[model samples]
Target: MRQMGRTNRARYLATFLLGYALSGLLTGTWTSVETLMDYFKYKPRILCVESKTKPYFAICPFHKEEDLLVSGSIRDTGIWDSDLTHLLKVALSLYKEAMLVDLGAFIGYFTLYAGALHHDVLAVEPSNSSFKRLRQGLLLNDFSATIKILNKAVSNKRSYVHMGKNQKLNLGKMHVNSEKDTDDRENALKNEMIETVTMNDLLEYIHVKQAIIKIDIEGYECKAMEMSTAFFKEVFVPFIFMEWLIIRTNMNSNETACTWTDAKRLVDYLTGLGYTPFAYHPVFTLLDPSAVLDWEIDNIFWQHKNAKSLLPYINLLRKVGPKYFDKMDQNQV
Candidate 1:
């Protein structure tokens, strides 16, 4: 009996040790596989395996499939900016055959699409790296002549300004407070001395009577709006889609932290501009519009007051499109 007991104990110990070793090996293998998949998922690939069928598919440098051009190019490395493609679609719907200005044109994804639709677009991007990608995309998509690609940042004043990190890629921060002063960095790499043009300047240069403007400048949206105030008064940009978010980031010398601007200021500005704010997702806002909703980070379609005539199109958009409605119900309330 004693001999049998000893043998069983030895077998049990060996089995336990074997199981532990197997678990470690399996875990390591799993981790390696996941890492490999992730690396390939974001690596830039040829979006076009076949030319004719893949016109719309460009390998996303960020997403690995040229499915939707997220940032300035496929070379960008960051989380996807969900609003870029959707906003482009919305703008295209409104200005199918009109002239448009794409302020902060990162990789020219929107510019290329707008130009493809045969709409004259003034694609303005401030980042040299991002602009290079934009230029490549325009050429690859054959939109060089269609789009007037400008490598400059638009601001209230025409002078040199600093370009921030990630190169026009959406840092996911909402509303740059034009009213509030941010920390000035003399050593930031993304800084540039591009020509700052106002809406008036754009009109003077482009010689257009009306336009559809899409503004997506990291957090300097309010500044852009302030600069465009004159143009808004003079010209007839009936449709304007601006990025309004509540961004949390380190500011004031990367030491201070704050929740940038709440959506109210931009909404108020739009309201003041005689544009009615349309919430992107109504279902989320239907629950409580006053409460901060996160279903749609980007709120769009602040049309001029007289542009209410376009409600049918708006309604159609909400019905058949990817936008969230009831978003602006709180503004009404």
Candidate 2:
């Protein structure tokens, strides 16, 4: 009986140790696999994504594809900016044909979409990697001939400016640092010098009689607006779609920060030029600029006084609902 007890004890100890070793090995292997996937997931690739409008090929970074473009149930459904695209379609329907200026065109989703719909598009991108992808996407979708590509940053001036430091993990956050006030050497070292052009200069070059302007240049919208105040007064841009950011309350700099003050100034400027602001909450509703408290949403549309006749169309958009998905086929080039 004593001998049997000793053998059983030895077998139990061996089993416990073996189980612990196997668990540790499996855990380590899982962690390594996850790390490897994260590192390689964002490498650039060309993917065919089905958009709400039409099927198009997107040259997407692994991060954007995994996180934003393909996160939902449908792959590359173009739902990422469905609201903006829907609004664009409504605007185009109002005007038989119009020119679209996609400032900060990124991977040219909006730019290529506009071109695919037979609208003339001016797509601007500043980052080298993004620009290359935008160009590739345009070509992939056969929009190269339809859209004019500009590999430069948009600002209130025509000069060379330092591009924002690249945050490899989040390329969309890349912005231009015009202030040059940061003391971080590492951040400064990451900046690349890029050509910048004013909205006035670009419009002059394009010479479109009336166009729809879409601005999504991070937080630089105010600066671009400030520089193009004269152009706003002189030209007849029927629609201005922009992403507005709340200004840093702590910011004491005289530079444009798209803060409340900057937003107020923009309101005054646009209203002075007979333009009205409306918030696009899936549907266009008149926006009281004074009531806006934060930059929580991404889409705002400004209508020229001349385009007030299009207000009824807003209700039509609301009534149509998800049926707009079918409209994409109707509008496809």
Candidate 3:
């Protein structure tokens, strides 16, 4: 009976391994086909291979001579890095000694890119599991020395926080803004406590020359911004981009603080502090403030009033086609 049981267990193990290998092959084959269909050239691709000489690196498609390579899992979103690099090049041209702060540094892909460009970087992430992956990416990309990783959530207050229950990342280190209506979203995840910090404290710790902040804290962007008022006042960060999405009417989540209503208020608040808000389009400049408040999907923003800040992007878009500019003007809120 014991010999028979062992044989059955071995058979089951072999079957499982075969199934896994088959699935992996099938997925890879499908991804290859999809890549060919969506792209005409390898220019949009960023390769990640096992190499001891350099941990991870990417060659700029637009400028082969200006490859901004680093250590990280480029396989996760190499295509996304293309978009990020384009944005970074523009930002760097604006600020000579730029200090980039990525508020929600998930997996550290964008952080590594910014850090590798010789910009001083500070990445703030709260989830231990997420931060683990982020740290690995930073180390793998060899960005450990330049990039400062802070494993804490930024909020309006500086103290220990209860992140509550979150199944999305399987970590309870997510921040909840009690000041807003976030009960439905919090309840969905289950509630627990986690560590927290304030923006003022973080800024004071990492004193830098210039800064550009990307705040994508899911929904806690409002609290993060409110807490970092000191930094906003002191530093002239030319850009402050956040994710604003229109969701179901029933979802009372603060995670969409960059939505139409919240973005209007936030943009107004920032501009009130002497910052000019500009709506960013991939093709051309649409300097309407209300357009951001009018968006139902995600959008980017330039906090400073420099009209030239978006000229290159605008020209790039216009070169694509006139329809891009027409649609942009039509979408203005």
Indicate which candidate wins on lDDT: 2
lDDT of 2 at 91: 73
Tell me the deviation in Å of residue 265 in model 2: 1.2
Q: Tens digits of per-residue lDDT for model 3 on 187-221?
A: 53355434567777776656775788877676666
lDDT of each residue in 1-333, candidate 1, tens digit only: 011134433443344344434545765523234432332332223121111111232211322232234532333422233344444444555545556788877655556656655667887777665575565455344454557777776666655554433423343222223333333434332443345555556766465666788777765555566656667766677777665442212222232222224333545666677766555543312212233334254445566766424455445554665334213121221
What are the C-alpha RMSDs, in order, of all predicted structures?
18.1, 16.0, 15.1
Candidate 3 lDDT (Cα, 0 to 1): 0.52
- For candidate 2, lDDT tens digit of each residue in 1-333? 011134433443344344334545765523233332332333213332334455332333334433343223124344456666766766765664678888988777777767766788888888877786576555445554567888888876666667777664456657887775343445544655677778776766465566788888877777677788656655568888887642333123565456666767767877788788877775466777665564355567888888735465566667777465445453342
Q: Counting only residues 3 or more apart in sequence or on different chains, how many pairs clash (N, Cα, C under 3 Å) in candidate 3?
A: 15
**Candidate 2, lDDT over the whole model:** 0.62
14 in model 3: Cα distance from truth in Å?
35
Any residue pairs clashing in model 2, and if so which?
Answer: 42-62, 42-63
Ranking by lDDT: 2, 3, 1
